[model samples]
Target: MRALVLAGGAGTRLRPITSTSAKQLVPVANKPILFYGLEQIRDAGVTEVGIIVGDTAADIEAAVGDGSALGISVTYLRQEAPLGLAHAVLTAADFLGDEDFVMFLGDNLIEGGIGDLVASFERDRPAAQLLLKQVPDPERFGVAVLADDGTIERLVEKPADPPSDLALVGVYLFTSAIVDAARRISPSARGELEITDAIQQLLDDGQTVRASRVEGWWLDTGKKDELLDANRIVLGTVTQRIDGDVDQDSTVTGAVVVEAGAVVTGSVLRGPAVIGADARIVDSYVGPFTSIAEGCVVTRSEVEFSVLMQGCVLTDVPRIEASLLGREVRVSRGARRPAAHRLLLGDHSDVELAEGS
Candidate 1:
């Protein structure tokens, strides 16, 4: 079986960051979010992969290349616009050909990979199979209704009154039948060919559709909080590995990772946390669930539950938690007497300042 990975959304929800970088490229635990999906696809025994890319095609291509590094041969399928999931499948038709394939959303992270799902799909050979998870807010996702025999009875895309709590989990398995289903459906009210509609079309055409419940976490990293949550969950699984230099003045504890070339001095690193390559943490408290990307510097600061991207600097910052900092972002306290906050943020940036700090 082949794989079609969609890395081409306009990620408006993660604005400012998404404005300059692909959302799929955003790091969770110092690793690109898209990379996790690719790795899972490879682990599922699917090496012939096609990435559906849009405006961020160049960036995704530069990072993924031919996908040989990840044990897959990648073919880039250029989608003219950020249309929809069904549109992405339609765009990758040539690469997918007549084979059964898996469609994975690049920004979605599923724990434990999709090996079992692929195996089940191969064993049963259903016309289409979907991964479904019971979500608190079914209205926020494409939901599914199941029949008595556990077959997918119906599918709805962001319905105001959802039929069930089973939300689509961003991983799909399909035989060639889905291509025609996608073509047969019209654009939804949102002006895109919805994948839910295509799946509904399959049901309407008397094709077998099945769903498997996600036993592990399924994170759709589309917003800031969601991304941070994903980071925390992924970090919790890290094992303690200190490959970098930790001076006697520094104290490290728990499942933390200090990559090679990173230096920690007069600081406390409390894991599950990761200090990326060449990063320096001095006289600071790098708290739990934090990922400091490569070349970053943290001095006399306390950071917890945050993601500091490559080249970010945090100097004399008292405490920062549950935050996401883009590359090269500098957060330093000024020596001015007034002691006021200063911020130069990009479009759609969200910041909360403490008064009288």
Candidate 2:
């Protein structure tokens, strides 16, 4: 089986950051989110893959070039517009040929990867196998209803009143039979050819559709909050490795990994955190579940549960938590403006100022 990875969506939910970089390129644990999906596909024994790219095509192509670095030969499929998931599949018909394939969303992270899912799909050869997980917000996702035998009975895309709590988890396995379904279905009310509709058509035709409930975490890194959570989940797997310089005045504890060339002095780094290459932290507290990416600098400040992209600088900022800073961002206390709380936030960026401090 081959793989089709979708890296094309305009991650409007991530706004300010996505405005400059593709959402798939957002770093989680200092690694591009797209890279994790590609790695997962490679580990699934799928050697040939096609990536669907849209306006952010250049960035995606530049990062995953020949795909050799990731152990796969990649072909870029141009989706002129994100007509929808079914539209993406329809556009890649020629490349997918008559083989079974897996469609992966580049920004979605599933625990333990898709190796087991691929194995199961090949073993049973279902018409389509979907990854499902129980989520609190079923209305925000494509939901599924299963029959008594555990076969997919119906599918709905962001339904107003969801019938089940099981939401589609952004990973799908399909036989070549799906091509016909994609062509047979019409665009939904949202003006895109919904993949859920195609899957429902398969059920209407009596094709065997199955679902595998995810036993581990499933994260869609399309928003800031979700991105930070994904960082925490991934950071939990890190082993304590201080390849960088940590001065005697600093204390680095538990599950922290400081990359080579990073410097820490007069600071405390609480673990499940990472300091990327060339990053510097001085007289600060790098609290749990935080990631300071390459070339970032943090001094005389404290932060927790946050992610800072490459080249960010934070000095005398006091405290920051549950935040995401884009590359080349600078945050500092200004003697003239900061006592009143000033901000220059971007679209979709959420900020909560200290209460009357």
Candidate 3:
């Protein structure tokens, strides 16, 4: 089966960062999230891939080129507008002609990979198979109701009251039957063709719909908090290694990965962290669950659980935590000044000034 990765969203939730970079390109453990999805697709034994791109098409193209580097041939499909998931599938119809394909949301992170799911689908040849996970907030996701035979009976997109806690995961396996379903779907009240509506049409028409409950971690990195959480989750699985220059004065604890060209001097870095290529850390404490991207600098500053993108500078800053800083940002010491609140007294009321001043 071929893989169709949806890379067209505007990522409004991750503003400022998404204003410049695509959400799928955001790095976790120094690797772009999109790359992770592509890697997963490659691992699933899919060699032909089609990436759906929108306004950020150029950037996505520059990053993922021919996909040959990852052992997959890629075709870039452009979407004119940010319509909906079903719209994306509709646009990719020509690329997916007559072949079953796996659809992956570019920003979603699935821990183990979808090799098993693809294998099962290949064996059974179901019309559509959805990955499901039990989430506490099913109202925020596409909810699915299953039949007694363990098949999907119905599905709804972000219902006010969910019928089940089984939320749809971002990975979906579909045959060419979905193309017809996509065409038959109408825009919902929200004025977009919802994918849940398309899937439900298939279920109502007596097409086979299957569900696979995922056992591994799945994260939708839509907002700042979820982005940081994805970073933490990925870093936790990293095994500590130093393939670059680490000075004698530097100490790295568990699960740290120092890429080539990165240098650390007189710094203590806790584990489950990554230092990207050409990054420099000196006289600082790099804490856990943090990813310092390529060409960044950390000097005499303490940072923990943060994602510092390329070319960031932090000097003489006491502490930084839980932040996703964009590229070329500088956080350093400000001009020295005396500490006090100064207020002007109007005529009759006189205020005593500090003794030193």
**Top candidate (TM-score):** 1
Q: Write the per-residue lDDT of candidate 1 for residues 58-90, one digit (tens) a residue.
A: 999999999989999999999999889999999
On residues 136-248, what C-alpha lDDT tens digit does candidate 3 reach at each position? 99999999999899999899899998999999999999999999999998998888888999999898789999999988889999988899999999998889889889988
Model 2 lDDT per residue over 223-342, tens place: 899999999999999999999999999998899999999999999999999999999999999999999999999999999999999999998989999999999999988788435667
Q: Report clash pairs, candidate 1.
A: none
lDDT of each: 0.95, 0.94, 0.91
What TM-scores do the predictions have?
0.99, 0.97, 0.93
> RMSD to the native, candidate 1?
0.8
Clashing residue pairs in candidate 3 (N, C-alpha, C atoms within 3 angstroms): none
Cα RMSD for candidates in order: 0.8, 1.3, 6.8
Tell how far residue 296 is off in model 2, in angstroms. Answer: 0.3
Stretches of candidate 2 exceeding 4 Å from the true structure: none
Tell me how many clashing residue pairs each candidate has: 0, 0, 0
